[model samples]
Target: MSEQMIEIQTKLYLYDLANLAKEHGFKADDNWEFSMANNAERISIQKNYFPTNVTKIVPEILLQVLNSVRTALKQSLAVKDAPDAQSIIADELNYLVAFNPKRPRT
Candidate 1:
């Protein structure tokens, strides 16, 4: 949970990474219906995709999760105390979304 360890250089660039993922989502036609779906519905349409411009909705979904956590903490009374929580969840989520398992870094 050490945010600095996840940091690139000294920029604390997790935000930049988040922003890039957001841009990718937007470019990928994130506004479409198929972009949002339930379990069965999603599996059904995995092959047939429209607005093929939308090649990266899954990342958008991860971004939404980060935003949702941010929103949750914003409304809470202890927002200042838990600043790193949102970033950590976002990082954990990116790890999960990107299928990055808990492997030792070389």
Candidate 2:
């Protein structure tokens, strides 16, 4: 897929995740940023989250996100001598965590 297409799709997917996270009480401090160079893509979210936050999200949505990440990771690795594999996966992992919910107001 073209880089532009990937960027658009990734953004949309993240948006959906953010909305779902909110519904489940995940808190985010900022937005996601996308950067690419030499076929290496980096996606970063402003805050960090926890694994429990992920469990709080709907299982179906988590499954969908997992699939999308797997596909994107696979596509990136398909390139000959891919250098950004670690970076890509790391960013995806961070994105997942960024949805960790904040403690409820007392």
Candidate 3:
């Protein structure tokens, strides 16, 4: 894959991971705070969000999700009756939507 495609894929994976984390009641913040006390002086520290147990599991889940997506894309592309790009996207969206926790099942 080209560099741009890899970048896009990484962004998508991170976006999905963030949404998944939020759904699980984890905070998705751009900034995280820490504190230090030394020699009777208080020090304030700020950095990006720290990884929790949930964040640690994200990589494994993301890899599985990406693998599934890749398999689906390959299968869709290999069909003798080729599906259009829109159809492929719609199918994938429907697959994802099926997992919505708030959606009422028929």
Q: For model 2, where is the 10-residue window of minimal lDDT?
A: 37-46
lDDT of 2 at 59: 25
Lowest lDDT sum, 10 consecutive residues, model 1, at: 95-104
lDDT of 2 by residue, 1-106 (tens): 3545545545666566567556665444533222222111111222233222221222223323434544653433233432344654433422233233343222
User: Candidate 1: misplaced stretches above 4 Å?
Assistant: 1-34, 50-63, 66-106
Pairwise lDDT winner, candidates 1 and 2: 2
lDDT by residue for model 1 (3-97), tens: 33222211322344345446545443233221223344344344343212122223323334433433432423233333243554444422211
Off by over 4 Å in 3: 27-106
Candidate order (lDDT): 2, 3, 1
Worst lDDT run of 10 residues, candidate 3, spans 37-46
Q: What's the residue-level lDDT of 46 in candidate 1?
A: 41
TM-score of 3: 0.27
TM-score of 1: 0.19
Question: Which scores higher on TM-score, 1 or 2?
Answer: 2
Per-candidate RMSD, Å: 13.6, 12.1, 18.2
The lDDT per prediction is: 0.32, 0.37, 0.32
